[model samples]
Target: MSDTPRATRPGKTPKHGTGGRGAAPERDHLRADCANCFALCCAALPFAASADFPVTKPAGTACGNLREDFRCGIHTRLRADGWRGCTVFDCFGAGQQVSQVTFGGVDWRAAPESRQRMFDVFPVMRTLHELLWYLTEALAQPAARSVHPAVRRTLARTEELTRADAATLEAADPGALRAATGELLLQVSELVRAAQVPGRRKNHRGADLMGAKLAGTDLRGANLRGAYLIAADLQRADLRFADLIGADLRDADLRGADLTGALFLTQAQVNAAKGDKTTRIPAGLTRPAHW
Candidate 1:
């Protein structure tokens, strides 16, 4: 709803444990660990008064629902209370990284003077972590094995950047890093899609298909990067091996849709869409509870 790329649902503990600082970044480290975090996402990200959020909140201001222990006071009823966006946001473990490693485990409340800076650095770190998530996924694609070395090098460099101090992180350029990594991911997508869906794949990159009646469409191996598919009726669509990087899937119906092996499909995208138990999602992503 907020259009932010999420990793996992908030207020829920991830199944994996986090590694210590200075260790190599792994998939586990890319997940949100609310226990080690200071509720930064609740304080840093601004929310508009929309269907996703009932109240208007500015950046750097703590949410009214955040409790003393940095947990959501209404965690059990966020959606019922019109805080659906919070459930969809994950911060991709950026909250803990900024709270523990970047700020040396010092919370903004304990060091009030550092609050603004911490809030400023949170989004920057989130971008780096999100890129790391995509790069990690790209590295795991067997069809993209040819670019694994490049992906590894880029991932290593990105991980090193995440270890920088708060000031360095706030001043870092995630856009440039994203561009470089995006090219490699494009190559990976091409390799994977080509191998998975042989001939005459759909080319709908960046198309405006909002609310289009696309139910049961054979869109396997389609190039849908940056496409606007909001509120589209995609029930039973064959999306296997499709490139969904940066696609807006908000409210798109995915009931019974086959998304197996979909490239660059983030949990945030899936969570934002409409789905059911029959939807076949890619491995490593959980079905939205609302589904």
Candidate 2:
């Protein structure tokens, strides 16, 4: 038997509603159940053969690796196989929305006719869910508290769109969803970037800049604690006054970066950086003795 690690999810709680401020702190929002979905994105989206994704699949064709049970056949060996991209990617709660609400919990095996319906819902639901992930993360920022009220409202609005019925989800104008999400993401970016403006950048607390390209940038007074920065490109960047507590920095490029005043960066993160001895670290972060 393959010693593959499968996610054993027992009592996993998905967000039933967006937690407004004053609500109880939410438990973790786990990876969505793809089996519950119609496997819509997998069937509806197209992938080109590239370094990031080695295989090219056309729209409407399920990934060859996807089993009839709506699971990835190569789940355990994603990297060993050509599916490393899928393994690293997270759909937040999109897979669940597309599976349950959009399709009313119908699967291809149950109703072959629903296959086309699943395709119709995939693109729309994916876009909304992606925005939800960003907006949800943005709401967690303390330094951005001034904008928290607006951020929370926007998150709930976007979350509502994902839960719309099929005819509503399908007939809904894609332009509207794109425009709203684009505006919100742009606002969040502007708020973060404003602090990086020439000698005038404001601070961001616990913001989400995961997988963002911030090469050779200045990020002084930024509060980035508990952010998901996996594989983010921060080469030669300045990150002074940044809080990095509990942030995931795996495979993130921090070479030639200056992290003076950044808080809560662990020794493990320092070791993960492709930095030279000359690289500057914040007082909060100490170089591993091994380094």
Worst 10 residues of 1 by lDDT: 1-10
Error of 1 at 215 (Å): 0.3
Please provide TM-scores, in order, for all candidate models, with all chains considered together.
0.91, 0.63
Error of 2 at 86 (Å): 1.8
Best by lDDT: 1
Q: Candidate 2: list runs displaced more than 4 Å.
A: 1-14, 20-30, 188-198, 201-236, 239-291
Q: What is the lDDT of residue 157 in candidate 2?
A: 76
User: Model 2: per-residue lDDT, tens digit, 92-147?
Assistant: 45656666656656665577887776777777776666556556555544545667
Model 2: pairs clashing at backbone N, Cα or C within 3 Å: 37-99, 195-201, 195-202, 204-223
Residue-level lDDT for 141 in candidate 2: 43
Q: Give lDDT tens digits, candidate 1, residues 5-105.
A: 22322233323222354232358778777777788888888999999899999998888987777777877778888888887876788887888788877
